[model samples]
Every structure is written in C-alpha cells, then in structure tokens.
Target: MEVVVSQTAFNRIRCCVFDAYGTLFDVHSAVGVYREELGDRADQVSQLWRTKQLEYTWLRSLMKKHADFWKVTREALEYAFTVAGVTNPELFEKLMEAYLKLECYPDVRATLLTLKEKNFKTAILSNGSPMMLDSAVKNSQLYSLLDAILSVENVGVFKPHPSVYRLAEKEFDLYPNQILFLSSNAWDVCGAAAYGLKVAWVNRFQQPPENLPFQADVEIQSLNELPELLNIK
Candidate 1:
C-alpha cells in the first residue's frame, strides 16, 4: 500500500524521528553470532530477551522507577538465559558486546541518506542509553547521516510514554504534527499518534495492527518506501 499522508499533514512535516532498535537495527542479530552455541534455542532466547527488555521499560515507567536501557537489557538477558537454560558466562558477555554493534537493516542506510539528501531533519529517538546508541550508530556507520541521536537517558523513561515522544518536539523546536515519527513497534506508533505526531508504522515483520486508541497515518513494510512516502523526491 502507498503512504497515506494527507496534503495538510504532509506539508507540516519538518522533521523525521525514528526508533533505533528493531526499526533500524536487527535486534535478533546478536544471537546470530553464537548460532552454534545457542543451537535450536537461539530464536527463543532472542525473543524472550527482547520481550523482557521492553517489559522492564514499561514496568519501570509505570512504577516511576527508571533505569537506563543498558541495565534493563542486561537484566533481561540474564532472565532469557535462565529461561532458555543457556549458562555460559562468556557467551553472555559476547552477546552484550554484539548488541553494541547490532547490524542495521539493509534498507536503513540508503533511506536515511535519501532523507539527508532531501534536507529533511532526521534523528533517532530510542530507549538506548547514550553510550549504547553511540556505539550502535557509529558501528553501523550511520552517525554522519543523522541530525540527532536522542536517547531516553535524558528523560529516564522508555517509549510509549508521552514524555519520550515529546523529546523530538523539544529537540527540534517543532510541534508534534510537524514531525514524522517512525517505529516498528506498534505500541510506540500508537503513543506517538496519541501525542499528535504524524506517524508511520514501519511494519517490518508484517505484524497485525495494534488495537490502540490511536493509529498511524501510514504503514509500510520497509524503510525503502519512506522517502517516497514523505514525497522526498
């Protein structure tokens, strides 16, 4: 399906903000490094690790107890290890290191470059800590293509939170409708939409639409379609 931005909303977009993990980077990639060690359980471990990591973020946000993404990530990894019955300390360290350099999705660099060439302000809005984001972006060679790398470290909360969504408006000095927020996470898309941003849900995994109060203005299967969706050409 084509992007569905209305003319009015389309003209209001001054900046494009993206969620880092799962959207741009392959969060499951870390497990690929130890495919042999994980055997048949690699996928399970990755899924559980990611699920718990996000769960911790939401739980902490609601409880008003915030921790950086790194801590939450490590804690989630430990839980995944226990649940999956993987018990190598060395493998744990390796997995954490791999996460620092997660592979960027194939279409990310070209899409971001297209946006940059079009002079659209592009930024990363993520739950990653500053250090984590720095390493991932630099490692993926995406640092120069972006205008900003925003982290929840500044806000002490994870996504689906209105405050996290507000960081884009605060950083760019633009209203929510003037920013186009993209995320692979449906709940995040809902949160940004609810907060008044023009949103595009990058349904990379072909997941079902979320049953939330707000919905994204557009949905696409990959970043390759983004520039066209925004009429960047």
Candidate 2:
C-alpha cells in the first residue's frame, strides 16, 4: 500500500487517535458469535443493530435526550431483534456479551504496535461508554498498545460534537492539529477536521462520504496502508 502526501502535511502529525469500534475492531464478528441464535438471518440482524445503534445516538443527542452508550446499544439490539422477527431476550444478552468481545481487524494490532514502536502517541476516543470501551479494548488486547481510551460518557454527547474531540486534545495535552484523528465513520472524520485535527478516513467499505460539509485530510482503505501514509516504515 502507498500513500501520497506532501512533506509539510506529513511532518505535522505527532499523535494518532482512533475511533474504537469500526475503525480498529470488527463489529461484524460480534454478530457471527450469535449466528446460532439468529438462525440464517444473523447478517441482517447484525447490520440493523449497528445501523440503529448509530441512528439512535445521533437522534438522541440532537434531541437533548441523551442516553448513555450502553442504553443506546441495548435499544438498538432490541429494535434489531424485533425487526428480524425474533423474541429472545436471553439470546440478546449473549449477543451483547459477544459484542464486548469483538475482535480487532487483522492489521490493527500490528499497525498500532508499529506506531508505538516508532514512538508516536496513540489513543482512542469513542462513542462507547467508559465501561464498554474498557471491555472492548481489553478483549481486543489493545489496552497496553493505547495510551488512553476515552469515552463520550464524560460529556454526555456523541461524536461530531466538538466537546468529544476535546477529550482527545485534553488527554494528550496537544492541539487538535497535532493529532492524527482516524475513523471509519465519515462524519467523525469531518467533525474532527472541523475541530482542527488532520483527519484520516479509514474507508474500509469504499463508500463515499455522507454529504458532510468537510472532507477528510486523507483517506485509505486499511491499517496496513496507514504507516506509509505518515511516512512510517
């Protein structure tokens, strides 16, 4: 993989901050753990759960009716199960437990460890509640690789909010521009950019941006391609 960036842009990043769930971790794998419960409709159930989880957060955040990330996640699961014509609460709990144990992407541990070896600061700022983020990081074996695991719970809001970005800034004691903010979610990339971070959109799905008012500073498909983007070996 190759990344083309001007020398000036390459020189500016000292720290790398990642969005936890879809960026480093594979949310889909969590669905597979519960495939037996969902029968043949596991794929649809998983997709809907993810989609609704995000939608619930955005809507609740906008309406000022903020529920913590855990509640929203559970609600999304409930809705997904209902939509899939399933009615097993115990099965759903098992699925949620599996979600906490979602695996990291194939390249994630290696890339992150490489970044650490190169002495670049690393952290995760996620929409996940503190408890959820902690479990996810621990399960993925990323706890030591990351310097900090930040959650929006401190602010009672979600990503795309400037305050959430501030959590990263405050943790590293650096300005937003000094941090390389990466997310699989386009709106997050846009929001971080607007907040003055140099953004990287990990376009794992190869989809176009969702009409955000701003664009990412860089775009790449995988963490395997990331080191080259920042001129790391």
Candidate 3:
C-alpha cells in the first residue's frame, strides 16, 4: 500500500530472490484444476483444501515437527476432504498431481527474462522441499532462467524463519541490502525485511500486510510493475 524504498535503495540491489508458490506460480488457484474432478462440490472442496494446506504448514513449523510441503499438502487434502465429507481417495491423488503441473503466472517468464537481461542474479527461496521445487521447476521449464532454486528443506524449516533468509543471502554471497526479496505472502515479505534485505510484497490480491511490525520496501499489485520499481529500464 505504501512505498518504503527510494530510487537509490532500489538501484543498489544486485540480486532479486523470489518466493515460489503464489509469488511466481499460482498455487492458490490450484483448485481450478480439481473443479471438474469434484463435480458439484468443486469450488468448495478446492478452497477448503488450499486453506488447510497452508494452515498445516504453519502449525507443523511452529511445533518444530517437520513434514515436507508435499507430505503436508496431502495431509491437508485428507483433512479437508474429511471435513468436507468427501470419500474419494483417487480424486485426492489426482488433485495433488495437478499441483506438480501448476502453470507459472502470466507475467512470470517475461519478468524473469527481463531481470536476467539486466544482469541481476535471480533465484527462488521457497518453503517447498527440494524434490517438490525441483519437480515444479523442471515441469514448468522455467528452471533455465533461474540461477538457483533454494528451498527450506536443507534447513528443515519454512519461510519467516530468519535462517532461511540468511541461507539465500549466503548462497548468493550478496549483502542483505543488495538482494531484493519478493514474495506474495505478507509474512514472508516481513521476514525478509526483518532479516534486512530490501523487499517487495507482490500484493497480487491487493490485501493488506498481516499487521506485522516490519514493512516491505515496496508493494506492487503484480510483477508487471517490478522492473519499473527497481529502475531496470
């Protein structure tokens, strides 16, 4: 909703790290892929499943009991189905597989190429497990443009964990101030900002931040405006 960084600050960023899932790929709308599978209850089932999946991730991380994203995704699906009173295990598996085949956001590939042409190092810092991210990246064919696809799996944690933010900075050997971390999840943007990296909150839904004490350097509705914010042109 507000711009916190100056043109000078944006220009200093040498690498642009992004959050996967909702940031680059439309993970939340994965329900559309399962709508036909669910028949009449399609929309409700899909929404419930996605909501529970993210809740499970946060709960599991807080308990310090780790399950990779895929495992948690399945567990959440099962819980959601049980809550929704659905009985088909076959349909559940089919829906989860659809996640493996998620399409990138319309502006993603073009934006990545634009950043690359500007000579900025680009990578993904995700809560996704190594195999989960690898499968998604490989399947989407966007891995070629990425310099690194770092995940929290190596640290057995999730985003908002300061350590995960540090891991990305270390991997690129860039100063925290030199990296511009972008995420659609407000908490993740807050975390990266707290960790001292310049941050951009991709408020794709035009929602407010989660009332966090920290703020993003810039907040844009989509990646389409990112190059302009960073003065890439």
Question: Which candidate has the highest lDDT of all?
Answer: 1
Best of the candidates, TM-score: 1
TM-score of each: 0.96, 0.95, 0.95
Clashing pairs in 3: none
Of the candidates numbered 2 and 3, which has the greater lDDT value? 2
> Positional deviation of 113 in candidate 2, in angstroms?
0.8
- lDDT-wise, the better of 1 and 2 is 1
Q: Write the per-residue lDDT of candidate 2 for residues 9-56, one digit (tens) a residue.
A: 857788999998899888888888778777888998999999999999
**Candidate 2: Cα lDDT at 193:** 84
Stretches off by above 4 angstroms in model 3 are none
What are the per-residue Cα lDDT tens digits for candidate 3 across 1-233?
76766778787899999999889888755668767667777767767777887788788889999889899888888887887788997887787888887778888998898999989999999988888788788877888789999988878987788989998789999889899999998888888988999899999888878787888988888899888888885
How would the candidate models be sorted by TM-score, starting from the highest?
A: 1, 2, 3
lDDT of 1 by residue, 131-181 (tens): 999999999999889999999888888888888889999999998888999
The TM-score that candidate 3 achieves is 0.95
Error of 2 at 14 (Å): 1.1
Better of 1 and 2 by TM-score: 1
As a whole number from 0 to 100, the lDDT of residue 137 in candidate 2 is 87
